[model samples]
Each structure stands twice: as C-alpha cells, then as structure tokens.
Target: MGTSGDLPDGFGPTIGTLGEDPLVAGVIERYPSAPWLTVGPGDDAAVLDLSGSRAGALIACTDTIVEGQDFRRDWSTARDIGIKVAAQNFADVAAMGGRPHTLLVSLTTPADVPASWAHELADGLAAECSRAGAVVAGGDVSAGTEIVIVGTALGSLATPSAVLRSGARPGDVVAVTPGSGRSAAGWALLRAGLVSSAFEGLLSEHRAPVPPYPAGVEAALAGATAMIDTSDGLVRDALRIATASSAVLGSSVVLDLDPGALAASDDLLRAASALGVDAAAAAEWVLTGGEDHCLLACFPSPAVVPAAFRVIGSVLAGDSGVGVRLGGKPFDGEGGFRHWS
Candidate 1:
C-alpha cells in the first residue's frame, strides 16, 4: 500500500527516518550520554542534563494520587487522574524553581478495570508531559483496589541554592502569577447545584489546575528571591516562605481579573446568594484552598515584576502570624487553607 507521500522505491514509512525499524540486536546495545542527547525516549530512563550554569544538585519529588484520597471514583476518569497526578507533581517541582526534565509513573488498578483505561491513562500522562516539554521515561503496573498513580520527577536547577519559601524581606514586593480562586467556588457549586453560567470556567479550573510551569523558571531567572506554588493555600504557602526565609508575608489585592475569573466570580456570587453560602467567605477558600497550583513569589523590584506576575501584597516584619487587610486597612480575619481546623 502506497500513497503520494510514500517512497516510490518501496521505502515505506518505517524504512525512512527510523533507519531500521525491524532491526533486532542479539547482543546488548550500549551508548554513552553526550552533550547533545536532546531527549532519548528509547532508553530505559530518559536523562536531561542542563549545562552552561554552575548548578548541579538534583531535586527529586514524588507524589501519589489514590483513588479515594486524591481522586474520587465518581468524579474523575482514569485519564483525568493521570493528568492530575502529573500536574500536581510538576507543580511541586516548579515551586522549588526547578526545570522538570523527566517523569516516572507507577499505576495500580483493579484487575476488572478496562484495559483501554490504562492506555488512556498513559496517553493522558504523555499529553501533560508533552505540554510541559518532558517525557514519560519509565513506569510500573500492578493490581490494586482502584486507580492509584505514583509519579517521581527529576528537576534541573539553575543553581543549587533555589528560591525557597523562607526568604522574604519586610518591603519585598509580594506577587503571584495568574491568580484564580474559582476552584473553591466551583466546589461549592457542585455540592449545592448553585453553579451559574459565568462560573463554568472556574468549575473546569477546580477540576484541573492550570499552573504556569515556565513561570517558575522565568521568575527564578528574573531573580525571584523567594517562591512557592499555591497548592495547599495562599496563606499556607506564604507561611512556608515566611518560615523558610525568616520573613513575614502580607498580601493586598493587586489583580485585574481575566474574563474567565471575572465571570466565574460573578456567577459564584449569584449562586452563593441563592444557596445561602457566604460569597465573601470565598476569601477564606481563595486564600487557602489546596490544588489551585499557582505561584506566589517575592520580587526585589515591583516595577520589573515578570510579565505575567500580579502584585498581590508585600512581605512585612512582624510576629509569625497570617493577617489580612482591606482598602489600606487591616481587617481581623486569617488567610489561607489549613488542614483539620
């Protein structure tokens, strides 16, 4: 079978770029790593080594998404689970200001589950990796009660010393990249059926965190002194930076909401009114809800904050406490999400 794009001399697709697709080696093959390996997927494990900089410490992160604890059987599909797992782990890497190079996955599922489900899961993983410009190097499969995903990622750093949480100054410009609190509003809507048309995008955001992975790298490249991903909650993340860098964290609203976020908030406000859910309480959820997977950072120069960076608040010198202020006034309420009260 041949087409216009096919080789007229019988050189099929396989015979073209692959050199020898069916070629089998009786002996074990070996190749040494080089400066220009790019990304070799055929190897047992993909290896990416960043050069030109003096940094040389490997930061590894591993996370597990269980069927019940992380993802509900009724809410998310297998592919969704895989994508979430990868996204969450990558978020952690970004929080540390590292470039994710390779990912390893392990899957455990019930024997009765559809085989296509696992294939789709792999597809989802690959899709996210492609979006993140990484690769699915190797993974394992086993039996389990339900869907479970384990991912281990390798990260490259510009320097061994990274933009940690513990290093904010009293007047450092506190900023965030592409902020969104719609996840919390969407969750409430799903529970109360108060979802409105304006907030549907927020519902999708709640389902999957759309973090700017490159933002971390850019922030670090732009000399971000301290940074953390907004996974646990903004307050919790700010606390981590405050503790790690021995700095106090403070925030003030400094965002011009994008259309999606604006619409979502409006819809949620209406829905909350109908359901008796305190719409203003969204401050609590937005400041603390986990899984949003955004970035909170400190900048030395507020004027030169990265292109996508949004000015949130400032890092102050004070007692180790989380506080919030409104309209240039300090209000009495806590910020961020905390697990178990």
Candidate 2:
C-alpha cells in the first residue's frame, strides 16, 4: 500500500493504529468546533446547543454512497466524493426548509487505501460543510472491502415548522433552482469518454455538484407549500411530492410540467449531438438526471415563488392515481435513476 507521502500535499504521513493515526488526527483538527456544538470531535459523542433554536426543532437526514454503486474512483477523486456526500446530506436538510448545522460521517475503506485519500476526503467534507455553514462534529472509521461513506446531517428549521412533501395542493405551482440537468449531462459525457473541454463545466458539476442550499430556506420563507431535494431526478422527485400530497389531500394530484419551460439547454444539446443522439435524448437528461441536488418546491401561487426558483409546472387534480404529465400529456418514458433498475 502507498503511504501518505505518496499522496498529495496536506495528506500527512501514513496510517498507524486508530488512536495514533495521523489521518484521524488530521480530520479531528480540521473540524474542532462550531457555534452550535457544545462538544466537538474527540469524545465518545458530540453535544449540540439546540436550546437557542427559535422553533426548538431539529431536522435530521442520512445518506450513504458506496464505491461501485454511487461512484467510481476513476471517475472522481476522494475529495470530490467527500464533497458530493456532504452536499447530498445537507441538501436534505435544506429541502425541509432548515439551516444546516452539523454533520456526522462514517467512512469505511480498504486497508490498502492510501492514508492521504482519507485526509483528502476529510478536507472535502469540511469544505462542503463550510459552504453549507455546517461542521463535521464527529464520526467513525472502519476497514472494509471498498470505500463507503455514510453522512448524517443535523439542521434547525428556519420556519416554525418544517416544510414537507405532503403539503402541495392542487393549485400549487412547481418550481426548481437553475442548473437541473448539468450533472446528468456531465455523466453522459463521462460515460461516453468525451473529454472535450467544451463539456468541462458539465463534468465539474458531476464531480462536485453545487446544490442551491439557500433556496430551501428562501422557499420556506416565501410560503412554499411543499419541497424536496432533487437528488433522484426532477420528474421522479416531483412525483414523490405529488404522491405524498395526494394521500394527504384524499385525491390524486398530478404535476403538469411545461415542456417549453423545462427545455434542454444548449450544452445538453451539444452533448447529445456529440453522443450521436437526438435532441430528445438531451431533454431526457434534463428530466431524469439525478445528483444535481437542487430543490423542487411547490408554492401556493407563482407570485409567491422565490426569485431563486423558476416556475416549471403546476399541480392539478388527477382522476385516479398520482402522476406527472408533460405539457398536459402522459409521459410514457422511464423516470430518473433507480437503485435496482
């Protein structure tokens, strides 16, 4: 196995016993304390000061990314993986109209993996947390066959109550943050091995997606009826809101997306052409591409929608089951990425 010296700068020396490992020590040093943390890393557990929360409510969500499943080492660096994991976890809190506060990460890696990889991973996690105004309070490490990262995010509701997916009404207007399909388009370009500089923007998005973290709280403050993080895909996450709202409202709700409003961007079209596919294929990426981690929200009216979000669809009363329609027509194509096909 390679030592930390074999890795990049700031990676420090090779790994030793867990208690004496420089990598673990480096991570602890990077994330010492935060305003909300009463007790930071180094102890058996961390303590938080939630008494100052106006709502006295804490929002929590956890997500895991596996080596072969969620990402590929050849496709992304350890730092990129860390940023992605932290982004997705924090996005969940933002989706619920909360302010992200702290994160707990559990990392499992093979013994042969370089200690610097772990150090870079911690740096990445801390970077993303800093972007979200949060900190890595504590976590655990274990040996495994492949790298796996499990992140749990803690947040406080900005509003009196957390916004939920089940709050959308028939008259609600659906909106989303900008740059929805760039990550998916980037993935397509990567899968095709098209490393042209023209698509570098898209490729970067895939490696380290910059989710609109503030939009969630803005939507909540602007009177959003319901919300979700677009980690899965646009249409699929939209359907999630529709279905959840349907059950609560005792009626089938449909999200009628405006095709013109959700049209593919020039970059996606270019990617599609490079891949020798039709424009529809590019449009599909916009519709079904996941990992953008943008927010999809429903507001009571278009006028109430926040400036950060653009109106893309509207909620309608459905006849039988909850569903989605593009331009008032049934979408027959497959939805976004699924765990098990």
User: How accurate locally, in lDDT, is each candidate?
Assistant: 0.62, 0.86
Candidate 1 C-alpha error for residue 233, in Å: 1.1
TM-score of each candidate? Answer: 0.73, 0.93
lDDT of 1 by residue, 191-256 (tens): 675445665666666655567888888888888878888777665666566666652334322211
TM-score, predicted candidate 1 vs. hidden true structure: 0.73
lDDT at position 154, candidate 2: 91
Q: Tens digits of per-residue lDDT for model 2 on 47-124?
A: 987787434588989999999878887888888999999999999999999988889999888776767777778889
Please report how far candidate 2 places residue 253 from its true position, in Å: 0.9
**What RMSD does model 1 have?**
9.2
Model 2 whole-model lDDT (C-alpha atoms)? 0.86
lDDT of 1: 0.62
| RMSD of every prediction | 9.2, 2.7
Winning model by TM-score: 2
By summed lDDT, which 10 consecutive residues of candidate 1 come out lowest?
Answer: 21-30
